[model samples]
Target chain A: MADEVKLFRTWSSPFALRIVWALKLKGIEFETIFEDLANKSSLLLQNNPVHKKVPVLVHNGKSVCESFVILEYIDETWTNGLPLLPKDPYERAEARFWAKFSDEKLWLSARGILFGVETEQAEARLQAIQNLQYLEEQLKGRKFFAGETIGFLDLAVGWMANLLSVLEEITGYVLIEEVKFPLLWKWMQDFSDVPVINESWPSRDKLVIKFQTMRDSYLAGKI
Target chain B: MADEVKLFRTWSSPFALRIVWALKLKGIEFETIFEDLANKSSLLLQNNPVHKKVPVLVHNGKSVCESFVILEYIDETWTNGLPLLPKDPYERAEARFWAKFSDEKLWLSARGILFGVETEQAEARLQAIQNLQYLEEQLKGRKFFAGETIGFLDLAVGWMANLLSVLEEITGYVLIEEVKFPLLWKWMQDFSDVPVINESWPSRDKLVIKFQTMRDSYLAGKI
Candidate 1:
């Protein structure tokens, strides 16, 4: 039987975009079911009861939740494309490590800068910059986090290329100055230049407005 | 060159124990270098500069830092073993999701209960139990999380079998009662019964003393 791929996602989620980019990169056809996260569909609720989050990939009736997990699934299931992860065990571990680091540490630090209380923003910004420095070091002498090609780590950290800028604009906090994180700044440009990624991002204007409203809500203690 | 596997770990850490269980499960010969976490060896600091935590597996000269990442490394490098992750992409995704869920959500909830401030303990206990209920449901018909054999998810959550009880004892809050979570409770027994797992665990008495001191330090605002 031919594979039937469907993605449950919101329009603006970077997590969902990771799967979209992976599918596009792999040249796989998929149905994108845009979800209103405020009122999530029963399909998403059923597929991802634990998190009830977006970027749930349903393939051949089996559902894969979690973006990184879905990315690995997409790579494993669609072997015709350039491999997302390296074949060597050590290299694969390194990729997975950075991918996880990007999501958990770097992303969380960015979130702190975005949503933290006014008193805490300065400390949070410093933490985010420190985390960004790690990414800067990782990108040294490499085009992407995965090297030469845009691969798993690139997709994992891709949000920083665009969404982070929107966040910086909304919060008036410039965490990734070119002077501060030169390689990472270059990486942002390199990541956004990828045809699949460049073509797939949501409108920057829409994201800025969306994040600005969300940041306001966060500051008001409504979220 | 012959494969060289060395594990940097603290004897009492559940995270370190996960790597220990994985290596032993594969019947792979490895050198164990015990780290005094308070006064960590330069080898460990150099190997895992990011976290500077234990369960750093250095195979040949390359080091894999995170425990879950290390588990995958072990599975991929040692192909002769009964697979840590399932062969099917879908099953592998499911295992990864649950493994992540265990480490991030369930484990953090347990931590909140263990070290959270006095006023937060009640709420944290409820959250931990809610997370445990999710695990109970996942274990409905299965003997282990990966079915008849203990695999990735099993090792990911194996800490609950031993260390959770220590936390409960130290904090005086029982999170896992057989009547409340019969299946998860049984799965814990089954997980601990595995010879390698049973043999490798730190002394329960020592753990209680260690955790009690840690918990006191936490409540005393020293940690």
Candidate 2:
């Protein structure tokens, strides 16, 4: 493996997990370096100075930061493997839109539930419900964000598989329950069942514990 | 000019503005089709059913959504023009990194400041200042986000030129003044002065009144 790939990542980071999933799907074996968020390395800062966050893919000593960008780089650099983006120009643009949508729409829905000191818990619930409603409407007749197979949106939103539980655990609410958001519920089950994804995902229990710690710290004015 | 390119855009949207800059820089004459957000056309919905957002570039009947994705499509289709993205693989990847940096980092900063509720105004300012500090560090000695010339990053963050005044008019906070964010302040000047950008920009007075009306409407509980 002379052309080995290396990554600087964080275990609970959805961004980092997305990269891990891509690497696994491609069957590319690479070395992983996990950084403790509380005590990050100088190298991580150097690699991603603007954001200084995780999931930096260093391919052949060159670094590509940002998870989605890393995904595109991964696709472009490797010509033969499973292509994450589509071949059609419009289709590729559509994939990128959903990937962007996953963050802008879904995260707001989830984050509205997760953080906020002044907003009523009921308002957060209402916000989260509205978000899920919109998502459910979008997923009404589609198997995935794209037509058939999992594409960028799946990777973009797949973090919900791990982090949704953390929000539920903290707030004592289940936003993705089968009764309320059946499409999202069903999609999660199918997405996680993908063989590569099933094998590559980090421990759910560990992520919950980590999210709890972060929440506790935020509440205690420690973050 | 039957085969002229077409653009679906709004005045305030940075993403759409990016397409304008690219097309203008390349000396391509395009028919601008402005979309009314309040009453979106069936065509806009059909073109980008996923996001239902603007800056959708229609070339020869096919549409491309998302500014970064559209930039790529423009580069690929208009191969003979002044390149927005670099040609080399490594350099291209890095250009993408910064472009993603604009979307991932700078955008959040611009958004929170522009759209945050009144009580969250302070937090929005904090995010803006933090983002500017990060940019200063990233662009420490480098002339532009892309070393020598105005590249993708410049276009990516160019919306701040239109957005700065709107945020100021709405919140009465000046984040991009000459003394406070000198580099970024100069950046606005540098970005706006290019003949292509200067000629293609939305009238600042029109944009100010639009933001004022929008802000008044938001305060009046219409939005």
Candidate 3:
């Protein structure tokens, strides 16, 4: 039986976009079901009842939720073209660790800078910058996070290549100065140049408007 | 050279204990270096500079940090033992998902019950119980999380078998009533009855005393 793959996603969610990049990179033909996160489709809720979030991959009647989990599923199931995770056990663990760090530490701290209160934004920005420095150190002399080509860690932090600038523009937080994080700056340019990634990114102008409104709501205590 | 395996752990930590259980279940010989979390050892700090936390498995002089990441590392590297994760791609994704849910949602909410302020305990307890309900439902007819044998998800949530009761005693909030979570209650009994888990648990009396002091500090605003 041929594989039937469908992804539940929002255009602007980096988590959802990770799945898109992975699938496209692997040359997998999958259907995309864009979700209105505000009024989520029943299909999404049914597939992912636990988190009720997007980036759920429905394949051959089974659904996999969570972007990281979905990414692993794609790599393991589609075993052709590009492997998302590395082949060696140790390298695989390192990829998982950095992917996790990207989400739990880097993204969480960065999100704080985007949405945190005025008094907390400075502290959040500092922590986010520190977290970015860790990535900079990791990227020292490497072409991409996975090295030579886009892999799990590259797709994991791919959002930063585009959305980060949008965040900085809205919040006036100078997060990724080239002088401070030269390697990361280079990585951003390199990551954005990947054909699959470049083609898959949401419109930057639209993302800026969307995030600007959300940040406004967060600052005004409306959401 | 023989695989030099060493696990950095703390006896009272559920996260660390998961590694101990994984190593023992795999029948791998290893050394254990207990860390004084208050004044962490340089080895622990150096090995896991990112998190500076325990449950680091150093195999052949290379270190893997993060309990979940380490668990995967052990399963992949050792291939001989009882498989920690399922062989199927979809099932593996499910195991990863629940393991994540166990930590991010279930344990986080339960920790709030143990350490959250008095005014917030009720809400935290409610959220923890709700999270447990999800686990209970997952265990409806299965002997263990992986069906017949103890697997990744079992080890992921193995802490509740011992520590939940201690937290309940410390906070005066009953989380797992037998009537409310009968399946979970049975899983707890079955999980504790496993030989490795049964033998490896810290003394209940010591845990009670330790948590009581920690809770006192939390209540007193000292920690």
> Which parts of model 2 have CA positions greater than 4 angstroms off?
A116-149, A169-172, A177-183, A213-223, B1-5, B25-29, B35-53, B58-64, B76-80, B103-150, B160-194, B204-223
DockQ of each: 0.93, 0.48, 0.95
* Strongest candidate by TM-score: 3
Instruction: State how far residue A125 of model 1 sits from its true place (Å).
Output: 2.5
CAPRI-style quality class for the chain A–B interface of candidate 2: acceptable
- Arrange candidates by DockQ, descending: 3, 1, 2
TM-score between candidate 1 and the true structure: 0.94
Candidate 3 on A1-223: residue-level lDDT in tens? 8989999999899999999999999999999999999999999999999999989999998999999999999999988789888889998999999999989898888888888877788888888988888888888777998889899999999999998899889888878988999999999998898789899989999999999898887778854
- Against the hidden reference, what TM-scores do the models get? 0.94, 0.75, 0.96
Clashing pairs in 2: none
lDDT of 3: 0.91
Please identify model 3 stretches exceeding 4 Å from their true place: A117-119, B117-119
Return the candidate ranking by TM-score, descending. 3, 1, 2
**Cand. 3 TM to true fold:** 0.96
lDDT per residue as tens, model 2, B76-122: 67777787877666667777776676676667766666666765767
B125: Cα error in model 2, Å: 8.9
